[model samples]
Structure formats: C-alpha cells, structure tokens
Target: MKTSDTTDDLRQKLTHELARKRALLIDRHPNARNSLRIMLTALGVTDVHHAGRSVEVLRQVKAHHFDMILADYQLEDGRDSQQLLEELRQNHLVALSTVFIIITSERAYHNVVSIAELAPDDYLIKPFTADELHGRLIRALYKKHFFAQLYEQLDNGAFTEALSTCERLLGQESAFLFDALRLKGGILNALGRYAEATRVYQKVLEQRVVPWARMGLAMALRGQHQLAEAEDVGQSIVTEFPEFTAAYDFLAEVQQDLGKPVEAQEVLQRAAAISPNNSTRQRLVGDVAARNNDLATAEKAYGNVLRRRRGSSLKNLDDYSNLTRVMLDRGHAESARQVTDELRREWRGNRQGELAALIMDSLCAAKEGDAVKARHAVEKAILLHEALKAEGATTRVSQKMTVDLAQACLATGNEATAQEIVRQVAAENHEDRAMIAQVQRIYSKAGKAEKGQELLAQVGREIVELNNRGVLAARSGDLQGSVQLLVEAAERVPNLQFLVNATKAIFTLLELKGWDATLAKRGLRYLALAQTKDMRNPKVISARETYQRVARKYGVPIVPLGPSRSPESGPG
Candidate 1:
C-alpha cells in the first residue's frame, strides 16, 4: 500500500508539471489528434497547440520556443517527423531548450529514429498511456536542462571550458556519461590533443561499440595524420555497423585523403542507396561524381538534391550550378538553355547566379553554332566578373565562375581573353594540382594545351616567389606584414599551403599578443579558403581547430567554415 501511494504521488506530480508545459502536438489524422488530446487532457494539460502538416509545425516552431513538441513520425507531403527534426536541428529556428518527442505507431519509425542524424529527445510508441508519456517527457526535459551549459560553451567555441565541464561531469555516475565522454573526445580533438582523444575513445570502445564513439576514434586518428589507421577504423565501422551511416562519410573522406577519389565516390554511392532522402549526401554524390566525370550519376545526384531540398532552407546554389554544368556537357542544347533561362528567371539579381547563368547561356549558344550570341553572353559574364571583383566571394564560387567564363570565351573564339582568364585561374590555383589538371583539360579540349602548360609553370613559379616573400616577412617578426603579404599570396594562389600556413601563424601571433578584429576576420576567411581546397586535409582541419580555440575570444560563432557530408536520413 505504501509503494502504491508513492507511485501515485510521483505520477500526479509529473502530470501536473506536464500540464503546465507550453506544448505543441502534431498529427496527420483528426482521430489521432483527438486520441492524443484526450491523453493530454487526462494528464491535466488543458491547453495544447496542434498542427497537421510539416509546414504548419515549422511555422509554429519558428515562432515560439515551446516546452515540448510531440510530433507524429508519419506525416504528409513526403516529409516525416524525422526529416522535420533534421531540418530544425540546424538550430536556426529551434531553441536548444525545446524538448522534442517523436510519436509513432510503426516499428519502422524506430529504425528511422536510430539512423537519424538529429534524433528527438524521446519517442513514444503508439498506444502508450498518459502516465508513460509523462514519464518520457520528464526524462527528456531533465536531460535538456542538464546538458544545456556544456552545449552552450561548446557552441560558443569555448572548447577549454567545455572540456573542463565534460571532465567534471564524467566524474559523476549518470545516464549521460557516454554523451559526456563523446563530447570530451571532440573537445580534445579540437584542442589538437589527438593522442588524448584517441585514448578516451579507446576506453569507450572497450566498454561497447558505439558508432558515435567509433566515429570519434576515426576522427582522432585522422587528426593525428594516421590516414591508413584512420581508414582501417573507418572501413571497419562501415563493414561492421552498416546502420551507422556516419561510417560511410568517414570512410569516403579517408579514401579521398588517400587520393582514391574513385573509391570515395563508390562509398558515397553506397551511402546514397542507403539514405536517398538526405540532401547533403545527394550533394556530395553529385560533387564526387562530377569530379570523376561520371556525368550521368552527377546529373541524377544533383537532381536529387534539388528535389529533396525543394521547400527547405538548406537548398544551395551549388547544386543548381553543378546540374547546369552537367546538362551542358551532355550536349543538350535546348535543355541546357531552358535550365539557364530558369536560373536567370529565379536568380535575377544575384551576382554569382547571374554570372553563372550568363556563362551557361554562352556555352549553350556556342554549342548551337551561334558565335555572335556566345560572344555577347561571354562579354556579359566577363562584365559581371569584373563587377564582383571587389566583393568577397568564396574560392569555390569564384573558381567555378571564372572557369565557366574561360570555357565560354574559348568556345566563342575569343582566344586573347580566354588565355588571360586561364592565366588568372592558373595563378589563383597555383598549388591545387587537381585544379591545374582541370585547367589543362579545359585548354586541351579547346586545342590549346601548349599555352596551358606554359602558363601553369609560369604562374606556379610566380606563386612560389610570392610565398617565399611572405615567409621572410614572418621570420622578421613583422607579423602584420606577414599576414598582409600572405593574404595577398593566398588570394592569388588560394590553395598554396605555405601561404595559408603563414597566415595562420600570424593569426596565432595576433591572438597571443592581443586580438585584432580585422586580422581575426582575415584569418578566418583564409581558413575557409583553405578548407575548400581539400575538405579532408589534416592541415586545414588543424587550422580550423586552432581558430575555434580563439573563436570565443574574438566573438565568432563556432560554426564550421564549409559544407559537411550528411550521415542522416531514411524516408518515413
């Protein structure tokens, strides 16, 4: 009788607290909402917000920070609650404090939840009692509150503080102990203490095979520059834990770092087959396919990204640009024209889009044997490039835009302008061997390889001399001069490691002495450029981690500098 009374009192307390929560309930069926409403009412939740569609739920989620969001896993519009969770998990609109609970009737939803990149705080299988629901909510809300500070510190780039918190929390026996260890490993990696991170991950693996921990182990190995070991671990994860979708990205990255783009592309293909609904994975598939000149696969992959990200905020222009390139390469003149026309129609005022569309228009025109129209379109593209010169564009965007322009000029019989543009491109990508090969391919396709080889070697020599000058400035203790010189060199030769490393060194010097806002922005911008040069490159990763340490000091967000591969998604 005493045990029953104690349970009753605890249940009553949870019901009362759950009642007081500012909550939202989402379900597609009216009967389902009625059933859930009755349960909430029985739990003393008198007031509840309701939405039937993903868009409606998103609107409410963006407008308010609710105490709880109970979303049905099954939904309309080809978007399940799992996709919605992934969408909002970017933290752009949803607050970290919000407790999300997935409500599902199907066992398939459980599988989806397991493989999802951004999982809900809790999930309630259908036919659950009001008491059971309340119990799960209590647990989830408690966890949200418990881990709030650690996440805040980490997101603000205070890795040192975050690390301290993780260590302190790990000392206590708790349900979140594994999470704490995982975060500790990440913090150690960000601090460039790869050896320490590897040890922590090893401890976790000895206890159990957790993909999150296993992924951390691979990352630590990669950070330590043990590519072979990292690949071994990554490949093992893929072979042993296929449901751990993150393994594919890690393995593919290792393959790319090992210069096996073909193998990496194959890994992504397998990942896409497993998770076709992921926009990031689709984009990556397109990227790797395009790099391998597999136009058919690239076209399909880019099309998938455009399809999947149709109504979401995560849609990127890169997909459209890449798709457009493939369409033109396939000799689909009318089709390519239609795409460029649509591009111009939508991105009317955007500089990069306008330039890209113009270049595409020129290419299509030239392919159709209209030299005059091609020349006109190429001129517009050149004018757009000149107009955007002073504005800062990402190296990826600039490289694609200029490369398109050069191809257009070459096709239009404008040899002088084409040569100048190729020279400029070669100069900028001086240290990027792959990019140089691509430039040579472009010239060879246009029957100008002799000129391309000459320009590549000349620009490479110029970049070497410029990098040396920047290094001398650093050795002389003229840190500011070193930064200025190296920044210039980096802009002229975006992937030149020596120049980027020198710039990073100056940024470190400034941070050690005192923070300069101007230098901080410059340093981060150069780091962004370096990352785009080689996503899996260890030097770039090290530079990014170092910047994260001082990111808090300089009031910068801890957001990554470039795009990331997706490890999430299965259709509902």
Candidate 2:
C-alpha cells in the first residue's frame, strides 16, 4: 500500500488498457484528427480511426465497436458533438461502456450543463497535454469498469437483474453511490414500479437539487398518471433551467396526454426554437402544429426536418411526405409537386417511396383542379398499394403514410377504397389517440364525419367484445379456450393491447400446464410485436418478466426484449 507501489501498479494498468483499446478521432480538419491520432498513438493506442464528417462518424460507429471516441464539438455538418451523442444513445447505436470525450476549443463548453439524457464521459479542452488526456481516459475507463455488470444487464434487457446490481452497488460507500442511485431510479421506472422510482428521486432531491433527479421525478409522476403534477414539475425545470430542453419534450407529452393539444404545440414550438437543429423535435412540432390547424407553422417545421435530414442516413419517406402534405393543405399545389419530385429522386426504385410519391402526386393534381392527372395518379397508386399488400410489404409503410393515402383516395372519389383503408388502420391502432384523430380529420375533410364515427364505433365494439370473450373464458377456468381466443384476437388485430394480452395469457397457460414449445414460441412473437409498438410500456415489461420466469422454470433460453447489439468487452 506504499505510494511508490501504488503508482507502479497504476502505470502498468494504464499501459495495458491503452494498448488494447480501439480509438476513434472525429474532427472536420485532417490536421486535428492527425494530431489526436498522434496523441492516442503516443499513449499506446495502436488501433486508431478518423472521421471528418458526421455521416462518416455514424457509419464508423455502426460498423465497428470502438473503446474510445474523441469528437470535436463543431462537426463539419453543422451538428455539435452533443447532438451526435444524443442521437447515438437514443438509437442504441453506441454501447454504454464506450469512453466518449468531447474535444472543444470553447471554454464555455466546460461550464454548460448537458441538456441531453446521456452526457459524455469527459470533456477534453484544446491544447491539453498527453498526460492530461491519459488521466481523463483512465478515470473514464475506471468508471466504466465499476459499472460493467450493471451496464451488461441493462444492455441485455435484464431490468430485474440490473436493479439488483444497483442495490448491491448502493450498499457500499463509493464515489459512484450517486450514479448508482440515478440508475436505480431509471430501472424502477422502466419496470413500472413508479412509486419506488418516485421515492428514489425524492431521496436524491433531499440531498441536492439536481435537474436530472427532478426530471426523473416528473417522469415517475407521469407514469403514475399524475399528469397535472408532472406538468407542474416539468414547467419548473423549464423555467429555472431553460437550457434543459428535455423538460420541454416531457412537458409537451404530458400536455398532449391531458388533451391540451394547443398547449402541447406551444411547448414543442418553444423547444424547437431553442434547438433548431434537432430533427426529431422539429418533426414533433410539425405533427402537433398540423393537428392544431396551424398550417404555416407546420410547413416551416416540416421544411426544417427535411432540410436537416436531406442527405443523412436517417432521412426517410416520411419527412418528404410530411412537408408535401402540409404544402398541399395550404393550397400550394406547385410546391407540393416539387417536394413529390424530390421524393422520387431521393428514393428512386424503392417501392414504398414510389407509393408515397404517387399518393402525393394525386393530392397535388387534385388541388390544382386537374381531374385527369389526378385520376391517373390515383389509379397507379392503387395498383402499387395492392401489389405491396399482396407481397406483405405493407408493414414497411408507416401508419401515417397509410392514412395520407386514404385521404388522397377520398379526394379522388374512391370512397369505398378510402373507407376500407381507414377501417383497417383504425382497427389496428384502436388505442392510438393520435392516429384515430388523424383518421377522423380525414373523414371530416371529406364531409363524411358521421360515417367516420360509425366506423370507429364498430371497430371499438368489435375489439372490446373480442377481448371480453377471452377474459370470460379465462374466468371460467377454460385456460385452453382463453389462449385460443386471445391468440386469435392478436392475429386479427395485432395492436399493442391485444399482443400483450395474448402473450400474458400464453405464458400463464404455460406456467400452469408446463412448457409447450409451440405455445411459447407464439407468445414470444407476440411479446416482440408488442415491444416494437412500445418497449417501455409497463404492460410490455410485465409480459417480458412473466415470460422470463416461465422460461427459466422450464429451462428454456430467454430471448432479449431489446434489439441485439454488439457487446463490449471491458478493458483488459
């Protein structure tokens, strides 16, 4: 335990760790990347990569797992390092164990609090010495090592195991106690134990007023359906710490759920103004603004979204369609036509993209009062839609696009086709208030409001009856009958609620009557489908836990609830 001996041990550890690491240097200029590469090489990192653009950074991260990433704050694509980090973490493209350091020239970067849910491991100021960089890497690697097990459990979708790990870490007096507490609150919230999550956040708040802890508490309150209280807390965070943009998003969601669309639109617009480069937030603003009949705002927000994602890998047909739809709504037929032309150019030969373009072309022609052109476009779109549906490629099309197509159909005098399309989408998304509202708007626009109401009521009644029958069968001790009925309902509707219910019923039956491979496989499929709809839903989590318990009892391998990603091996 002598000072000299401890120093020697640390030196050996650092040398070994650096030698085994794969490092990435991201900067707009070649000289900056070369300088950083030299520094990394001097520190014993032999595996070094360089990326000069944000797109290249994303490509490299997706293609390989790097142990260390050093990115400049100002990227060549106008995106900051903070935004890149947020995108990586949000999409689960980066592992939690990677040591990310922001290399910045601005001293203000060090003083600013990160508004993202995930913060970089460290910030490396310009003109820093190799020794300083070495020290930062060692500290970040040590923290990653300390939380290795918990990170693994979380990445593997083992929330219960991660919670236990958090508890064990909290039992000791370590520098990471607060970090462990933060993870514990998130895990509890993910598991739908909102009351416990609230208490954990409260405990953290008692010690200090942390923005993240307050945000966590607000989320817990929302999970418990305390919308008013959640809104109040969210407002406080926005007012007191205006830099914390995440609060704006949370508050907007709460407002939307509380049936305050106008308030939600206002909140999202404020956030978009503050973080104009955030494509996701811009898209949200566009959606809400369109829903509130604010066409000018909708057009601007959607235009921003398309501009931001124009040449990026994240660009999609939805972005182009959204802007075109807004333009058409504003009676800018020529503008909408231009956007549709761009869509065709950008997504050439892609079936879904072609379909989207055709639909938009039809809408544009109708708006321009060209009945012949509109009819021709509608016929082509109808043919493509049928072809995709027959080939089972319809699932690749977004629900929003499908609704838009139906609206086009109504505009083109294809009432039966529009009605059929709306009916199918409504049944599949019976619980999605937003989609339902969109469908209602389409019908109302066509002056068929009464017909839309009748259709929705019929779909709602059918779903309720189907679910009630399954419940009745279970209550009567006919477990087999209950499973059959529920599975049938899931196959027919395949919404989140039905999928979760079916999976739960199948797992319950398996628990009572021993494992049936066929039944378990079906249950897993439904659970996966439900997760695709909403991975963080309490119902999905509960269903996953039930399946895990049953699978363990029967000695079956449990599949992960989240998407599979490359696992990171800790430092050697």
Candidate 3:
C-alpha cells in the first residue's frame, strides 16, 4: 500500500512540473513568467494549460478567469492596457474590476497613467516580486471595498446620494477628492442646479485647470443664456484640448444660440471627425447645414446618420422626423415617405409617432392641394389637444399645435374657425414674443397676411393709447396711477417700443418722488426684458439709459447689461 501511494505522489509531482513549464512558455514576459511560476510552485497549482499565442493566452485567461490580472502597460497595437481591462469589465467579458494591475516599465509610467476611469487598481513595476504583486492586489481589493457604496450610488444614478457621500468623503481629503467633486458637478447638472454646478466647476478650475471643469463651466453658462461667454470658453477649451469631444458640443450649442449657423456646422464637423459614430453630432451638423441653406452637405450628414447605426441613443425618432422634412423640402417626397414608413414600423403606434405622422399628413395634404384631408388632420390634432386639456396635463405645450391647426383651417377656407384659434393663442400666450412671432408666421403662411398685419397694427395702436394715458397721468403728478397704467400697458403691448418707454417714464417719476428701491428695480427689470426682445428699439434703449441714470443717482450699482443700440427714429 505504501509503495502504491508513493507512485501516485510521484506522478502528481511530474504533472505539476510539466504544467509550470507550460505556463512559463505561454507567458512572454520574464517577470510574469517568474512571478506566476513562483505562485504555482508555492500552491502546487495543477491542471494548468498552455496557450500557443497572445490571443490564445487571453482566451484562456478569459475562460479560466484569474482573481487578478497583471496586464502589460503597452498591449497589442499600442492600446492602453488599462483600457483593455476596462473594456473587459464593461462588456462583462471579465469580472468587475478584478484587481487589474498594470505591469509597466519605468519609461512608460506617464503614458500608462494618463487616462482616467481606466486607472488600474495598482501598478506592478518591472522586476516586481511575487510578494509585491500579491500585496498590491490585496490593497486594491480593500480600497475598492471601502468605496463600494459610493461606486454603487454613482453607477445606479443615485446622484443626489452620491453627491452627499462625496461631500462627506471630501472632508477626509481622500485621493478621490477630484473624483468626488466631479461626480458632484455631474449630479448638480443632472438636477438642473446649473448655477451651483457652474460655481463648483469654477472652484475646481481655479485650483488647477482641468478639461472637465472647463466643460462643466461652459455648460452652466449655456444654461444661464450667457451663450456668448459660453462660446468663448468653448473655444478656449478646443484650443487647449483639441481632441476633447464635449468642448465641440458646447461650441456648437453656443454658436447656434447666438445665431451663427455656419460656425455651429464647423464645430459639429470637427466633432464628427473625432467620433463619427455619434448620431446626435451628425444630425446636429445636418440641421445646422440645413439652416445655413447648404442642402447638399445637410443631405449627406443626415443620410450618414440614418444609414450608419440601427440601435443607438442617436437614432431618435426626432432625427428621422427632421430628416424627412428636409427631404420634402429638397423635393424628394418619395424619399420622405420612405423614412416615414420606416418610422411607423419602428415606433409601432407610439403617441409621439402618431403626432409626427399626423403633422407629416398635414404637410403632404397641403402640398397636394387636398384641403379636405389637411383640415381633417388639423381637426385630429385639435381633438388630441382637447384630450390633453381634459387630463390636466400641465406639461402639454399646445400653442404650436394650435397655430398649425389654425393655418390648416385657414388654408381650407374655414376663416371663422382660423380667426378664433388665432385669437385663443394670442390671449393665452400674450406674454411670449417668440410665440407671437410664430403666430404671425402661421397667419402669413395661410394667406392671411393682411389680416395678420391688421391684428398687429391694432394691438400697436392700443399700446400707443395706453402709453399716452400713462404719460399724461405721470405729468399730472398722479404717480401711482401712472405706475399702474404703465404696468398694464407694458403687459398688454410687450415688445412695443412706446409702451416700454412709458413704463420707464413712470418708474423714474415714482423713484424721483420717494425712495422705492423695489419700484426702481422693477423698472430696471422691465427695461432689461424690453432690451432683450429688441435691443435696437428706441423704447428699449431709452429705458435702459434711464435705468442706468436712476441706478447711479440712487447709489445702486448699475447691473451689467446687454447690447442696447439706439433705437431708429419713430413717431413721437
């Protein structure tokens, strides 16, 4: 019995030695071979298989799975070793963050460590001993465990909780300070606390300029309607970090908002060059090109976006809707219909899809001179609006839909209904200048140009009468009456130059009578609003100048203002 046991032990020892020799042959690196061999010898690890090449070895590693991966700093084709590890984790091709240790030479340290998120759990220097590698792996596991809660919160989109944890962690001044701050900024942005988010970003930047910090600041500025400032910041980021994609997005948005369509397209082109797979970027380029009347480029960009990817975040139905419109505009009705059919198949009766199809129906019917079909579609839209209204859905923006329906109604010779619809939209959105302009366009498009002009002229005359009343009231020293009339007139005829002038006059007279900081500030607010709508309108400029004078006279610091050109001469 003793002799038989001895024979079995000898056979096992031989098998183990052969396996070790095979493992050594598979590992090309001297350190990997030596360190792994040492571990195998210590553990007497049996059943080891040898891989013929790097691909084979990686496949075996994937199949067998290691508790920790000691990857070379420079992998096949100059790919970052850490990134390969992350790709494995991300794709579930490997277990999560399985103690990835980047094995690097001293010369490659900087190159290996330059990337974020893909930073290894540890770095195993050349000539590392088995003991050193093992120690680093254990340390990484402990550190990861310590922050597991934070990792989970961040990954699960519990940004508010994550931000709170980050704040607490920041008090400890941990090595993850910047990461915490960055995560906080992202959370604040997600929550729409753009101003606070911007402050946090700037705070980090003031310490040391970082690409993300700069990008975050630009985003905040964009949120605040400070597009010009955002554009400048975006340009600076691009100049410094030409490869950064987010900077290009910021630049495109700023330029678009500032009415520079061509510049927006240029930024989008640069972005596409960097990341062509992004359907959103391609669609944006196409939209901007379309806006600039560059049909050929627009068509190419849209076609690329539609053709390239099947299932992506960039494959929004809105993109297809917009593309279809462009196609129709380019006299490709059949092509537009093809896209519409594809969308119908994809969406499979979604409400938004139905709405888009209806809008397209209206457009097609209008083009084909089928006024009856157009009116039917418009009525369907109105019915949808009625349903939404019954539901008390506050989020429903029905004005645009109403305007569209009104236009269709007018086109079909339902003048009475069209007039009533326009009146309803005007009354509901009397405060919004952009909405008013859209209303005017809808009227003009439906062959009601004279009617639209008459409506605005009547509104203008009403505003003028109110302005005169306010002016007379102020001159007669009835300050309260003057303020009341002017405020009412301003509301009634917003963006009308003379009414704004009347409001300014009354506010200044009130301030002159007594110290009403609130009144003065209210006057400045009206003045600012007026300036934004038409900076070159005489009333806006005069009010702004008056506010500046009042601010100085009362020792109130003049608030920083926007462009306010002197208004052109108009009737007194």
**Separate clash counts for every candidate:** 0, 0, 0
Worst 10 residues of 1 by lDDT: 563-572
Instruction: State which candidate has the highest TM-score.
Output: 2
lDDT string, candidate 2, 289-386, tens digits: 99999999999999998998997888989999999989988989899999999999999989999999999998899889988888799889889999
Order the candidate numbers by TM-score, best to worst. Answer: 2, 1, 3
lDDT of 1 by residue, 1-572 (tens): 13234534644555557767778889888888888888878777767888898778878877776778888887775667866777775433555567888888766765876676565778888779887986887777666656677766654444567778778888866679876777788767666688999999899999998777778888889888999999998888778877667689778878888999899999989988887776787878887787788989988998888776654455555556668778877777787787677777767687787888888888888888998998998998888777677565534355756777888888888888887877877776665545676687668778888987887888778877988888798899887777778777776666648545754775677677777677777777777666555533446655765777666677866655543211111110
C-alpha lDDT of candidate 3 relative to the true structure: 0.61
Over 337-356, each residue of candidate 3 has an lDDT whose tens digit, in order, gives 78867877776756555655
**CA deviation > 4 Å runs, candidate 2:** 1-15, 110-114, 561-572
Clash list (residue pairs), candidate 3? none
CA lDDT, candidate 3, residue 406: 69
Regions of candidate 1 where Cα sits further than 4 Å from its true position:
1-69, 90-98, 348-352, 390-399, 415-441, 449-472, 483-572
Error of 1 at 572 (Å): 20
Per-model TM-score, in order, reads: 0.79, 0.94, 0.48
